[model samples]
Target: MNRTLIITGKGKVSATPDIVYIRFPILVNDVHYATAVKGLDGIVASLRNCITTNGINKNELKTSDFRVNTQTKWNDNTKEYEFSKFEAHHDLLLQLPFDTELINNTTNDIVKLERNIEFQISFGVKDSTIYKQLLIENAISDAKKSAAIIAHASDIKLKEILNINYSFSEITFRSDLNYSYDSCLMETNEKIMPDLNPDAIDVNESITITWRIEN
Candidate 1:
């Protein structure tokens, strides 16, 4: 029989979000389909103009969804169905480089549209490839430190690494506990509620390693 020992270690590193994502939905409704489509086109044009004037790169702005729907209404007195109206809906997603001032200015400008809008904001690392590389290095360093500590306690030297396993914990954005706002206001504002506390986001990773012992 052979005797073996297993050790586990954890590492965490975090940095302020260097990128931002904004999602907004625009809705246009009218009695006639053509009118609704025209209204939607005008709104989209206005939004594009606002974004370009404010220095937001045109390539970063994109349409996420476009949909059209019709509604029917029932007349109680006549006991008949009546065609209500048709509406066009569009969802726009904007990817912005990390610039706090730009974000604030753009959001403020867009709010002037005053159309039916809903918004959501998220933050992330600017270069995901680099961030992932750093995470892996930290995990390995932590695993080595743990192994050394165990070897010292056991009064033995580590011979070789038998196996290494790594996993990353969930990564999530932190927001205010209870804060809600309409899309119009959200798009036009640069600062977000909860104030973006860096500590709130904790990036954790676990490493499980098996090391051979020198007898």
Candidate 2:
């Protein structure tokens, strides 16, 4: 007969976020396709100008979503559906360092380019590849420690590990509150700033390890 000891171990590490992301969509609607495209081009150019003038890197800017669609709508006067109007959308995402002063100034400048443009801001870490490796090491260590403790109590020796499985939990780097460009511009005297401070994000890892047990 074969015998084995199975145990699951959990490890966690917390770190502060180092970067922030701002996402906005530029929507244009016009009766003619040419007009809609032209409007989109102008808004996109203005967006690029604002980002460049604020010292934000061009590589950090990304176009996430872009689409041009034509649809039909009811026309009471014509007594028939019309498909002359065109709608275009350009979604832009901006990444920048986590600086209160810089973010405030950049956002103010961006709003000046277009007041009606709606934007949302979120915070997160720039890269977690190294941190993930560290967490895996910690989790393996924890699994070994647990197996050793069990083996000692049973007066048995733990052999080579038969199987190992590890998974990471979902992490939240931003708070529940949403940042709005129009809302921030509403405040006259006070320079409105979003709640940029986010609590430490926990990097949680779990390992399910199986090892052979011997007498």
Candidate 3:
């Protein structure tokens, strides 16, 4: 006669993000192409100055993108194409230690200079070693609990762990609120909370283990 048992377990763990990455896009528009470009350049200069003057590390600032485009309009009365406007867009990327207060302060200053700016912030684990260690410990604990439960149900005693299988879990990156015109307007000048909520992020891992049983 042969006896077999199967069990499943789940492990959950949460961590606060240590690092933040943000991308800001500033858009400048005017009827004149050169004027729009100049405005965008000035805004960029102001951003750099603000960062440097505020004591941000120089290495943390980087130019992610720059572009200029022209829009045209057709006149209904005169069957002619009219130069509508020109737009200059610049994207700036920044990396820093997670500090909500500092970020909020910096954003308030930036928005005062330019109204047509949008931002996206990403949070993640800075050290791979810490993440791996936490995940492995949680997985093992979950496996042990599952093995114990199975052993008790089958009227047996768990003798030893035969095998362990682990797969890397994906790191979830998301924002508290979706970015929209109305949301962005409300965020300006609003005091950002100093401590971010861990519930805003979800971190999980799974482990499969085989244990020997004695009956």
Candidate 4:
């Protein structure tokens, strides 16, 4: 029977985020379907203009979950459900460079475009492939060192690497947009800046190495 030793080592690399992701939505509601659709179109147009004026790339803007649906409310007085209104949602995602001033400026400008807009912010590294490779290498080195120490203590020789398994874990940043806002138009002068103190994101890699033990 062949004897083998298995060791698991973890390595982490801390790096500053080079990209910032900002996500928000414009919600429109009206008693009439046509009115709601028209309002949504106007709001989207205003938002696009705001993005462009801020010098943000058009390709960075993405719209999702654009839907129009009916809402029903319970009418206690009439003892029946009544069609309240049509609700439409336009979800927008923006990817920009990790400049604090630019993010704050763009966010402030975009918020001025509509009152029904709500948002969440997150930070991330634009290119993580290089960092990922470095972390894995460090993990492998750690595993080999550990195995060598254990073998030396046990008076055994490590012949060769039989197998290696590795995995990576990263942190995700997000906030749920479930707050209530007054249904009114936002004034252009009112600035909305959220405190965005981004810390170094840690990229962790864990590796398990199997080595054959020889006498």
Score residue 69 of candidate 3 by CA lDDT.
84
Instruction: TM-score each candidate.
Output: 0.70, 0.81, 0.64, 0.81
lDDT, candidate 2, equals: 0.77
Which ranges in model 3 have alpha carbons more than 4 Å from their true place?
1-4, 18-20, 27-42, 63-90, 121-125, 157-160, 172-200, 212-214
Per-residue lDDT of 98 in model 2: 82
User: What would the per-residue lDDT of candidate 3 be over residues 1-215, giving only the tens digit for each residue?
Assistant: 33444454566666656777777777888998889988887877777776766578756778899899888899998999988898788888887776777766666666555444566766765665665677678777877887787788878987666667777756454434322223365555654334444344445677787776679
Each model's lDDT comes to: 0.70, 0.77, 0.68, 0.76
Candidate 1 per-residue lDDT over residues 1-215, each given as its tens digit: 44556777776666666667777777888899989988888877887788898987766779999988998899999999888999789888887875767776776677655554456666666555555566677877888898788889888888778888875655453322222347645544444433432333346677788888865
TM-score of 4: 0.81
Candidate 2: C-alpha RMSD to true structure equals 3.4
Best by lDDT: 2
Which is superior by lDDT, 2 or 3?
2
**Candidates in descending lDDT order:** 2, 4, 1, 3
Tens digits of lDDT, candidate 2, 1-215: 66899988877776677887889878899988889988988887877777788787766779999999997888999899989678898898988888988889877776665435568887777777766777777888888899999899999999888999765655444434356665345643345565567767676778889998899
Q: In candidate 2, which residue ranges exceed 4 Å CA deviation?
A: 74-84, 167-178, 182-190
